[model samples]
Target: MPSPTRPSSPPSSPSSPALPPELLLLVVDAVLPPNPLQLLPASHPATKTLLSLTRVSRATYARATRLLRERCAFVDSARRLADVLLCVPRLVPGLPAVLSLRHMTALYLSPFGPSLAADDLPTATRVRELLCEVCETLRRLVVQMPFGSLDPLDDGHLGVRRTLREGFEQLHRLEEFVCLGSYPALSVPPEGNTDVWRLWPELRRLVLFGVPMDSHWLWWDIATLPRLEHVVLARPVGLDAVNIKDEYFHKLPRDDARLGRDIKVVLMDLVYDLGVVRTERWREIDPEERMTVEVFEVPLPFYGDETPLQLVTEWARRGALDGSVWRLGGTRVRGEEAG
Candidate 1:
């Protein structure tokens, strides 16, 4: 002990054991619930949290990044939509390689009018190219038209409209397609053929917030989709937007050879918009057949977390008398909840 022993280094405390990958995934799912049909907006708090998690560690980054890409990527502007095609790091902590766009399966494109930039032409083209690139993998798509219409008369933001029209033409593998905000006159394909059913042969669910002008095309198309199971016609405007007539019923698949599943149509009406009702009352419009129509009096506006898509899906599931008032918000207040 003659020589003073060098001060012993303080014992290092053991780092907390890393969370199991399974448990970590559970936490991630809980934080950002997986909704393939729902788009995770980048501005959303949950989305921001998930983006931050990508930098936590290699393990967390990989899992979080994977989940983000798998879920619907919300694109609000031309530039933002173009970004999805880029090979740059989506977030900081650039330890990992750039995310590949091939993993994107769902996409929501919402172009705001107020924020429209003059140089959007090139960006819009890139997005169209991006859609072509991911067409095979894209399964669910939601296009929100805030200030423009797919109709040529109210033609505004033609680029975004073209993107939407072309996106539909390209992404034929879609299972679910939703149009929010203004009326998207997607009834007729851009090619002028009224046979719009060919757009998404694999489509199962269609939620249109605004009905198209050519309601005949809408009816005709619904009859042909072999895989179509659900159709939500919300806030029907004009005289015959969702006018379910005997002729329309006649178009329905009469034989089992054509329709393997029953087609459920939910005609949704908001509290504000009041318009002509072609059918004042409808009861099991072809109960014996493969078509069933239900009219829902949606309690709230088509905004917020409880979107028209979520409400119509819940309301349509309730097996009630066709045209009965199935109040949405809580349990079936006036109808038989489906067993």
Candidate 2:
């Protein structure tokens, strides 16, 4: 065979076929979902590449910027959120009517210091402003209270609660409200009540992290949240913890009456000391009306000179001995349900 010859280089054109600007931008947007756009750092190589493309035409910039801001995550002081509002003043005008922080679908509010106190009003107001801007668009609001002596007094707690309640009223579209602090004062009103229920009419998921509650209140709230689907209440150590009584299920207003069938609830660290008694009671409730309780035991590690094998054996023994006794009618014992 003759020696292989290299293919001739394709001829360069003085002018190439140009795609319509709108169609080109649409193609780019179609290739990437909005999530990655939010995850990209401002100085990311990919972001720079997109920016360069935007400079090529106005349509590109419009599509790129819209995608970039669609799922924005801001973990800053309330003041920062306010600053964003002032920078984009025209974005928000009225309260409850139109939220200022509406552009964000997932919002995480983390106060820089201990507690969000009265002194933080200016920043909180700004946050409120931004929240109002995007109230209708917000689906998740996670408020993480800073650990430490943020609030030594009860007043600060009350203030925070009030602000949050007010915030909820505006977030009519909110589906999840996650509070990473003790907010026992925000207990749900008794069953058959609409006053507090109206505050979060559309709420579907509520997560309470590091909050201690009375068992009665916990079950009552679960029953009252008409549209609620998921609830996570994490208790702290050495508190008058809420345990799920077997009667927990019986107390639930008949599902067929108004609220739909059983609401599934997950209890973390349902410790034997506090939750076992209630758990046993829960087992006795009728299957049809009882609220389901799924318990998860946390493994606490002990510091000692025990060998790995010995430690594992001890752990396994502990786990096996800590089994839950289920009442005859309800679901199977923890960890025994069909996979």
Candidate 3:
């Protein structure tokens, strides 16, 4: 008959119970949206603060790691890229399983100091996998591989060529490709069936600076890209005097004549080099057709001498002396000719 032992009173709830570390991480992850980080705002305090938080606690470390690996893709340091790939599984295992690594699309590679050798192919392969895995989503690619003084005969060039060919092949989804320095020399023939043409079918914008202009006919291939609307050939060397003549106009397929028909602007700066000037015969071409060709000559000062404006003015004065039409007038310059 024992009055049934009264059940022990329920424990009183604590005023501010601590969140378990795992639960805290889950909360943080839930609050963060997995989206690619914008590269603008040259100076971002939030990014700096978030990077610093990774050092605070294990929970913060997990949260920060998830945010970075899921959103940011940078190639400033190869070692950093390696670290991110390797650490992703431990920090954010779910990311690799669910997210396409290539969606974080912009890539910047600098080969200025030394050529990337065959030994670097393993990491390059990982990068290629990441790129190809999300090829359907990539839009912009920026590569800065400086040729430096290496001879084309060296094994380094072979390695570079292989890497570039493999990498470029995977970037079939690229719309904008910017290559700085002199890697991936544009010696590929300008035939319609070339790999370059087949690789980027939708590329609309291309920027090649400080690279040799091996083939002016390559522009024909560029003109054929399905949706190419703008072309900016900057600092072109051998093909400066080359103009878009009727041959090109005719060669361009009218399959969808609308491709480059709307391309109303072109910017080119070809200096007066004897080899290029003599090799290319522009005067023999039809002036009436040439008159319709629009080109803007941008003055560049060699040996770090005068400003470009100064050079333009000097050339203008010289044109006046020679009784040539070359003066800054309305929407067009009166005397200065475009090449």
Q: What is the C-alpha RMSD of each candidate to the true structure, in Å?
A: 7.0, 11.1, 11.5
The alpha-carbon deviation from the true structure for residue 31 of candidate 1, after best TM-score superposition, in angstroms, is 2.4
Query: Which residue ranges in model 2 land beyond 4 Å of their true spot?
Result: 1-13, 16-56, 90-101, 147-161, 181-198, 236-252, 255-259, 269-277, 281-286, 296-339
Q: Say which candidate scores most in lDDT.
A: 1
Identify the runs in model 1 with alpha carbons over 4 angstroms from their true place: 1-5, 34-38, 88-99, 114-120, 146-164, 186-190, 195-198, 212-214, 238-245, 272-289, 300-339
User: What's the TM-score of every candidate structure?
Assistant: 0.71, 0.61, 0.56
Give lDDT for model 1. Answer: 0.58
Better of 2 and 3 by lDDT: 2
lDDT of 3 by residue, 1-339 (tens): 678888999999889977788876765554433433232111345445456656766666656644543333445456655655564344344332333344445544442334654455565555555555556776765555543333435535335444445556767778766554333452222332254424688786665543344454455565566666544444445554444443344454535454335542233343442122221233343332222223446456556677443454344333322223122121321112324
Q: Which residue pairs of candidate 3 clash?
A: 325-335, 326-335, 326-336, 327-335
> What overall lDDT, based on C-alpha atoms, would model 3 receive against the true structure?
0.47
Residue 38's lDDT within candidate 3 is 35
The lDDT for every candidate, in the order shown, is 0.58, 0.49, 0.47
- Model 2 — which ten-residue stretch has the worst lDDT? 320-329
